[model samples]
Target: MTRGERALLISVDAGSSVPPYEQLRGQLAEMIGDGRLPVGTRLPTVRQLAADLNLAANTVARAYRELESAGLLQTRGRHGTFVAPGRDDAMDRLHRVATDYAAEARRLGVPPAAALALVRAALDATRPG
Candidate 1:
């Protein structure tokens, strides 16, 4: 097993209610959030991971795609995917915070317009006269 995989203990329960792709995605995201999978750490190829886990390649690919979409991973063509770097500067931090909030809003079923309006109102209320 790769150091990252060994540290994260990525696994899938075939009989669990959660889908394999989602299961893999959640574990990877958790590892990334907790720093087990550090930025620039290359991931195993989709085929390789699928074979190791006894899952279809598409399952691993879906997990990787979702992570990439959520800004947790980056694919460098032939080089492969790696954990994305975390934000270090103020604006970058704010952007990450906002992205997290937006994700929460989505999970809570808040409409996109409603979520934006709420943020706007909050900002307006906090603004100096």
Candidate 2:
């Protein structure tokens, strides 16, 4: 296993109510979001990862697809998968913070409008005149 794969330490909880794909997806997403998996880091191939984790290839693929849709991972044919690069550093940080905020709001059972209003109010308060 490479340094990146070892650092990944991803696992699927077979006994959990959550599906394996979701568990895998959540872990990988959190790692990418927190920079534990730095941008452009190469990911293990679906087959390889599946073998290592004792999961079906489809499960790993599904997780990868979901993460890709969420802008966390990108796949290049033959070359394999990698953590998606930030198009712009500042925007990337903002996007990560925004994603974190949205997740926390949802976890707290806050209404979407309320969460958005809070963000707007924060931006307004912080904006220079």
Candidate 3:
């Protein structure tokens, strides 16, 4: 299902002790952790989601801000918000390896395009026959 559709599955219970923003944050986080909302999934705009859930824009905005601070979401200018890549140890290790490669490329004065092409070739070489 689409990210927005998955987000729409979240509901707030006004009568419950928990606040709406926290409820929204928790549900979205749970979905992301459980793979229902995978990495790179684009979330709805704050106003759109607020309208969808009958919430104030600030409510959804707060949730988005909190998630972004926690590294669970990333906002790309004009591209909207997306689920940040996983924070699990394996993903962390991969990120570290990629960072090291990028650093080495920078030290060697390799352009980004050339560095990316080298990585792509390595990936292609490792693929199963």
Best by TM-score: 2
Encode model 2's per-residue lDDT on 1-129: one tens digit a residue: 655554568878899656899778877877777778888888999999899899999999999999888778899889889998864667568767877886798789887789889989998999998
TM-score of each: 0.64, 0.67, 0.63
- Please list all clashing residue pairs in model 1, or write none if there are none: none
CA lDDT of every candidate: 0.80, 0.83, 0.80
Return whichever of 1 and 2 wins on lDDT. Answer: 2
lDDT of 1 by residue, 41-69 (tens): 88999998898899999999999999898
Ranking by TM-score: 2, 1, 3
The TM-score of candidate 1 is: 0.64
Report model 2's TM-score to 2 decimal places: 0.67
lDDT of 1 at 37: 75
Candidate 2: which stretches are off by over 4 Å?
Answer: 1-6, 87-129
lDDT, model 2: 0.83
